[model samples]
Target: MKQFCQTCLAGLMSVFVMFGFSISEEVQAEETGQTAYVDVSVATLWSEPNETRPVDAPSIGNPVDMWEWTTGMSYEQKLWLVGNLQTQALYGQEVTILEEQGDWVKVAVHGQPTPKNDLGYPAWMPKSQLANDASFSTLKDIKEFAQVTDPTAWLFEDKHRSDKFKEISFNTRLPVVAETKDAILVATPSDGKKWMSPDAVSIYSSQEDIEKPDGQNLVDTGLKFLGLPYLWAGTSGFGFDCSGFTHTIFKAHGITIPRDSSVQATHGTPVERDDLQKGDLLFFAYNEGEGRVHHVGMYMGNGKMIHSPNTASTVEIIDVFESDYYSSEYAGARRYID
Candidate 1:
């Protein structure tokens, strides 16, 4: 990736700033230190709105919605566990990190964000690395998460877990790198490297891992609807706005994210376009008036994104920085599950 001027890359000007990449369908061999864990916690529910208290509060039983990590702090790793069983997640909702009190979280969710709640991301994740002796499963046998439901909201199920809440699942994973220096567990061997020692925990969750599957088709399947139609505050399949489309995609993949384009920027770890991974989100503030994001898209790897533009625009795929529309509106780039 060619370098762009830092000053020019700020604000909407960054939108037009262009870069190019080449993506492939090859699954590289194993290497050491290739694992990670997404440190996920249920968003704390608010009791009341102090507005001035910094954090927003929710009514009783509202259920805290969406999963959040600091910029560069949270990431979903892509681990090739069990032949080809892998998972990719995008937070498909609105989240606002509160300031103080509940201020650490900003919450606006169409669905619930906890395991006990009816609406949550439920999947079977592996607690250990792939079997060194097992052969890779045929792609035909691997099942995509969405095939299991409609109006899908993420919820976890512990098929291998007898502990009820503690599930033993084995899928590819990512890490929250914003808060830490290295990636976490449930890793695959990259290149020729050996497994990395666990950093800060005894157990890890692959659901929080970054979104890099073993094949290009995974990313392709996640971003197939690059340009559909932009709807205002839309969270459905037929018509979706920029943030709406992005939030929904990640939801199907089993990760809850902030809703609005601006607030969504605050979740996950921060990464430059040059270092972006698939399923990561990109944000733009064509008009940085509210200190928020007006336009957003999903980083489908390579140089393309899946997003919904304005009322006059169609949900489609376009060069991130190639058009003046995004160029002039470009905000900073962020990676939630990277």
Candidate 2:
């Protein structure tokens, strides 16, 4: 009887192994929920299942309290990237849980895009970074809110950065409950009422602002972050990835585009390199004739293009044909705003 029982147990374990099921996996499956927000200062997105890399970390200027550290981020533009990776989602960016693979969770980020037949802005992030406290919703909700339009806008307890309360990224939309002449009162989920400069935000009255497809002032809006540092996978002015620079630039002008360079390459009408105009998106690859579209830039006429090149770089205008590296890898151009 004992020998028969041992054989049955062995068969059960083999069955479970063949089907790729484990006791711990079942526990994680039950604990994982739908949507989650980045609770930390910043959450970095990963390309593969196990990948998270930090970029150019800023020198921690004279140590100060939380308020000073948060406040100085605006004028000094320092101390924010201490231990963060380049491809990051700011504090409030929402992500939806798709599936759980051990300690990693495959998620689809809001406002980001993936290929047609694939999941939405699909990426794998550590399950620990996912939080359950905050609720995630679409950007079109019928609330009178102020959309952040600067590289990093500080929400002050009073009016200016001197009385800084908190800091938020460029694309983060905050609910506006009241307004003063110089500042707008915004309601945040984690923090209560906070005041921000009126000029730093664009107030939306109706859904027209969200649905508008015209790239009215994209290039001009993009030029605002000329001196900002480049972070990997960053989608806001606080720090911008190459594609993130294009994504947020278009968002400010009221157009929704894909998030990644490769996916964005498949968007918009194709244009010839010789016919490139202002506001047209230019992409690059590895080889001379062919490679995966890995980088993107916005043409600013005069043979110049604006891009957040890499982790050690900042948003800047560069000659498309000036450097042999960029000129050689030039893939093609696409016009999103016609």
Candidate 3:
């Protein structure tokens, strides 16, 4: 009887091993809850799922027309987007599904940390913009990854790069399947597979494999987007908000920060205004730096800082004390990189 029991136990262990069952994986899955990957090039998250207006249709569509969406909006309509839009998730970015509404799903976007949720920054996005396929979900397990390093890169349907697939934003990471001399084959969430030019992405064995860039590196990266339009809640190369610009720049260098300016103000190493260094975040608050944090910019030394100012302005570099509003509302500074 003992010998038979031992044989059965050994057989069960073999089966478990063969099926790739593990306690750690099970725990991780449970902790993660239901998850989905962003299927579009960039999915805009909203404060309210169904409250979007007709003007927002272009942005919510599968192939989002960001250029049209931003340029088509009037100044008043653009201002309306300030509090309505929460943030954006890039293609293949994993989000934990918190709840599901009629045609929308509430997801906590990973990488964009916030105090609103323990999982991540909470927001609502259309269900169609996300992929819950087993194949797509398994991409998190892949060790090799291709992280978009350029401001924007085109994913191609063919390795020759003739057929355009999608234009992915910077810092968008996808599972790398294979690589040719000049093109890399990557697995997309909804699309079967796509090819990207080697110049557009930096290959990494894992997230940890990405080298940490210095302060000057961050400033240089921000310089690439000079004059890019400012979009409320925007995080992509298409446009950027105050915090989003800082967040995306740091993310490209393998550093993740909070999604909102107010939340971001609380973290990182605090630096004095007089000792501001290159790449340090400069914050502005209401009530002349006494109230809530509202804006952020990257210090570029010599009293200059690059920032996405407001709905009316584009990303630009200016002296720290140039604007009367910013000068009066200069909150403080924070340093993420050593």
Candidate 4:
């Protein structure tokens, strides 16, 4: 009886090994709650796991080739991304893994708000772009963080800036490990640690420590991207869509807003057209302001607004009433900031 029991135990252990399951691994997964961080400079979230096309290969590469990804797409291909490409998450952003299928994972991005999920905006992204390091979960406890203030910044492997680690987009926040007079040591999602120049970032003790900027500050930040080519569903300095441009501009100032234009039109304080302030969000609809909300722009005061209009346009300032299309479809405005 003893010999038979030993054999059975050995067989069970083999089965566990074959299935790649262990007590420690199970405990680690439970502790982490399947949390992962974006490992790439920008991880594009898709409406579905299989929504990517052949031309999207460059966008998914390890060091995402944003330039090739944008310049390579044809006009039609760019328009196709309007609905199929959901949104994007910057490097080091935390996401709660909801589901996994093959090489893709459905995650709720922490900062982006949406009605699709109470946790955050829901979207599917390639699994390879995420880092599942258990150590990264501890970042939530770190009070001090370094936020990228510039349009773009490079992460260095050393303080001397000898080796380039990665080029991160604006608004990317990472837990600060240490700081020097000219550089900051930050904890990365995949890479162990990297250094950033103080000139490109601002240190905040906590999210509450960030001082809120007024409406004009928002416009000043938006103005930096003038002439940047528009990209559908883009949320990085490399490119931006209509709502993405507004969302990123607000996010850089420590404000969290909805990820979609239609959803964004619902929240925030409603402002009358005559009372519109600089940085107020102006929305547009399908049927002369009566139909579904489809587009959004930041009010630039004096009858102008800044927006990434469409795939064919760049980040430009335009007279809101200059174009008949926008004037006829103007849907009211909303104020996210007081």
TM-score against truth, every candidate: 0.39, 0.74, 0.89, 0.88
lDDT of 1 at 99: 20
Model 4, position 296, has a per-residue lDDT of: 98
Query: Model 2: which ten-residue window has the lowest total lDDT?
Result: 55-64
- TM-score of the candidate numbered 4? 0.88
- Residue 127 miss distance in model 1 (angstroms): 43
lDDT of each: 0.38, 0.67, 0.88, 0.87
lDDT per residue for candidate 1 within 155-241, as digits (tens), equals 222222222221111122222221223322121111111122233222223333334333243355445454544434444433355
Relative to the true structure, candidate 1 reaches a TM of 0.39
Full candidate order by TM-score, most accurate first: 3, 4, 2, 1
Best by lDDT: 3
Query: Positional deviation of 181 in candidate 3, in angstroms?
Result: 1.1
Model 3, range 219-242, lDDT digits (tens) per residue?
999998898889999999888999
Please give the lDDT score for candidate 4.
Answer: 0.87
- The residue-level lDDT of candidate 2 at 311 comes to 56
RMSD for each of the candidates: 20.5, 8.3, 12.2, 9.3
lDDT accuracy of residue 69 in candidate 1: 13
- How many Å off is the CA of 165 in candidate 1? 34
Question: In candidate 4, what are the lDDT values of residues 1-338, reduced to their tens digit?
Answer: 65466567658766877899684432221212477889999999997775688999988767787878889999999988877888899998989898766677889998899889887888888889998777666874654889888888999999998899888888888889989997899998877989999999998987778889899899999998999999888899989999999999998888888988998999999999999999999999998899999999999999999999998999999999888999999999989998
List residue ranges in candidate 4 displaced over 4 A. 1-33
TM-score of candidate 2 on Cα atoms, chains taken together: 0.74
